[model samples]
Target: MEELFKGVADPVRREILSLLRLQPLNVNQINEHFGDISRQAVSKHLQLLEESGWIKIYQAGRERYGYLNKTAFYSLKEWLDAYLQWGEQSLENDHGVFLEPTAYEKGAPLTHPVMLQAMLSKDKEFDGLFYNAVRTTGIFCKPSCSANPKPDNVTFYLTRDEALKNGYRACKRCKP
Candidate 1:
């Protein structure tokens, strides 16, 4: 947990994590975004992030890429959930793509075909009928989330707990 806190403590690291939330990026591409800073500095930050498990660096051919490891956020998510259970104030996320889904209750699991349809359509009716977890991103979201992850990377869960237990974390955007 201390590591997780340190991982997100830096402004530059937070920005890198935010970027990874959207998509994976190779080291050079990540460095390009921080033109004001030396690449060595960014590399150091990446190393720390990796040690903290917030990001996973891998060599994809000759280019090394960084991927977001959402499971690393699970502790934070649980802490937030505890607050929510205590009737703490909710945050209005401007980047959120789904809102109505939060008002619903979790439903039974649906068929794979049905889940696929809901995913593509972003069907609000199926928001709690099933959870859509993206393996590539290691994040799970409500069916109504507007983000379009590849179908090949998606899996279904009957409940958010089920998804979390399987090593996926709730989507920050959807907050599922």
Candidate 2:
């Protein structure tokens, strides 16, 4: 558990994980995602991730492909589930309304204003972090969605189901 925490502690490592969440990539491909970091640094991060069981590496002829080992995240998820339950209990007791925890509330960083700016700017790096749901249009879209809506009229959601539950449909453009 401590190893897992250490593995994901760095922002670079987290970004690597985020990239892997989308699809498996070779070390060179992963290194290309970061302009500031050297290939050696990325390789070291990959080694840590592999050691911590957060990722698995396999060779495909000349290239070594790294894929996210999602099962390794289960332990972290279990730990967070306890806190989520506590939060839900606290909310239920205080507000008299049960509100299920959203994915963003669990661990996503999309709640930050900077992340909102990233979404508005169509930053592809944050594509899987959250979805923008336009209240007026009743539609949800990916961060890179081509459809632009007023920021005031948009609410971000952690999942498509959350947006759908709130009466927002998936946008045709981004297909959230």
Candidate 3:
């Protein structure tokens, strides 16, 4: 746990973990996702993450892929959850700040799909059924969006559970 905390304390390492949490990526692919960083720098970060047991590497085809090791996140989750509780209270006490509906309670498993294939029901209103955020622009989009959606690298979630189940965090602005 100490080693995990040490590795995640760095901002760059956290970024790497967040990316890996989405999907496995090889060294070159990870570098491309974070285009501003030098390849060598990303490699060093991956090395530290591996040493801390936060990530596992496996060979896929011609390249090595890195995956986030869930067990290593246990301690970090506790630390963050402490504040998450406080944030919930703060929001409840102050209606001045708008709070989006959370898909899950702390310590509970996610309930939404990562990508949903459901055809929109004709009668369901778009109010809570469809959601997209400006930050995810060009990423996964709903059929209801006014813009052109991106490639398949992005995904759709049927329920909040499916999204959380697949490790995609909730959007803050346009809460899905």
lDDT ranking of the models: 1, 2, 3
TM-score of each: 0.49, 0.50, 0.44
Writing each residue's lDDT as its tens digit, candidate 2 over 1-176 gives 89899999999999999999999999889989999978889999999999999999999999999999977889898987765664446532332222344533535455556446656668665676788888888888998888878888888887778888999888888886
Locate the minimum summed-lDDT window of 10 residues in model 1: 93-102
| lDDT agreement with native, every candidate | 0.84, 0.80, 0.61
Report how far off residue 152 is in candidate 2 (Å): 45
lDDT: worst 10-residue window of model 2: 91-100
Tell me, by TM-score, which candidate is best: 2
| Displacement of the residue 142 alpha carbon in candidate 2, Å | 45
Q: Give one digit per residue, the lDDT tens place, for model 1 in 1-176.
A: 88999999999999999989999999999999999999999999999999999999999789999999878887778866644543434454322223233343455345676678667878777777689999999999998897999999999998889999999999999888
- Tell how far residue 150 is off in model 1, in angstroms: 55
For residue 104, model 3's alpha carbon misses the true position, in angstroms, by 29
**Stretches of candidate 1 above 4 Å error?**
86-176
lDDT of 1: 0.84
Residues 15-60 of candidate 3 have per-residue lDDT tens digits of: 9889998899888888987778888999999999999999999987
